[model samples]
Target: MLATAQALIGRKVDIVTSSKILAIRDASNDPNEG
Candidate 1:
């Protein structure tokens, strides 16, 4: 049960990190926003 919980948390972290990276990329791509 502990391992499963760890895996779930890890997946959520990965998703959040990915979305953050995409947001940064999008901001960089738009000159008006920067």
Candidate 2:
């Protein structure tokens, strides 16, 4: 999902480190938090 978001936005995300995001880790299972 992170790759998809990056593709759509054409750039990497700049979210905070402690942000509770789906793509925060590589073992994420959610597909809607990128």
Candidate 3:
């Protein structure tokens, strides 16, 4: 996903890859969240 983001923006991205992931919420289908 990080690679994709960098590709879209055409720049290096700074992210906390070592940190523990807290939550991943998928609200794609929900209109309110989207």
Candidate 4:
């Protein structure tokens, strides 16, 4: 199931991974939360 989804959305995973990394970087810059 998971593998099928991964195969179906390989390009999406790349985008999602970049977005998640950006979110984490932005989160790190914020002082309100850890």
Candidate 5:
């Protein structure tokens, strides 16, 4: 799952990973989005 996320976001596993995770969750939970 981490590998998949890294590939999708083109980011490395580091401190910012947690923030990126929150962003992903927020995007997924947005009702106004697809």
Candidate 6:
């Protein structure tokens, strides 16, 4: 299920922009809750 979603997203994103989108998403969802 997860792999399918990943494949869909990969197909939708342009290669150059995907990394930046992922970086922003990761930053916004920071796990260290302190």
Task: Give all candidates' CA lDDT scores.
Answer: 0.63, 0.61, 0.53, 0.65, 0.69, 0.60
TM-score of each: 0.38, 0.28, 0.29, 0.37, 0.35, 0.34
Top of the candidates by lDDT: 5
User: Comparing 1 and 4 by lDDT, which wins?
Assistant: 4
- Show model 6 residue runs off by greater than 4 Å: 1-18, 31-34
* Backbone collisions counted per model: 0, 0, 0, 0, 0, 0
Candidate 5 pairs with clashing backbones:
none
| CA displacement after TM-score superposition, residue 21 of candidate 2 (Å) | 33
> In candidate 6, which residue pairs get closer than 3 Å at backbone N, Cα or C atoms, i.e. clash?
none
Candidate 6 clashes: the total is 0
* Candidate 4 residue spans exceeding 4 A from truth: 1-18
**Tens digits of per-residue lDDT for model 4 on 5-30?**
88787633323345777888877997
lDDT (C-alpha) at residue 5 in model 2: 84
Regarding TM-score, does 3 or 4 come out ahead? 4
**Deviation from native of the Cα of residue 8 in model 5, angstroms:** 36
Best to worst by lDDT, what's the order? 5, 4, 1, 2, 6, 3
Model 2 spans with C-alpha error above 4 angstroms: 12-34
Model 2, 1-34: lDDT tens digits are 7867886877866554555564456337665655
TM-score (C-alpha) between model 5 and the true structure: 0.35
Could you give candidate 1's per-residue lDDT for residues 1-34 as a string of tens digits? 6656878777532223458778888778976953
Superposed by TM-score, candidate 6 places the C-alpha of residue 7 at a distance from the truth, in angstroms, of: 23
State the lDDT at 34 in candidate 4: 47
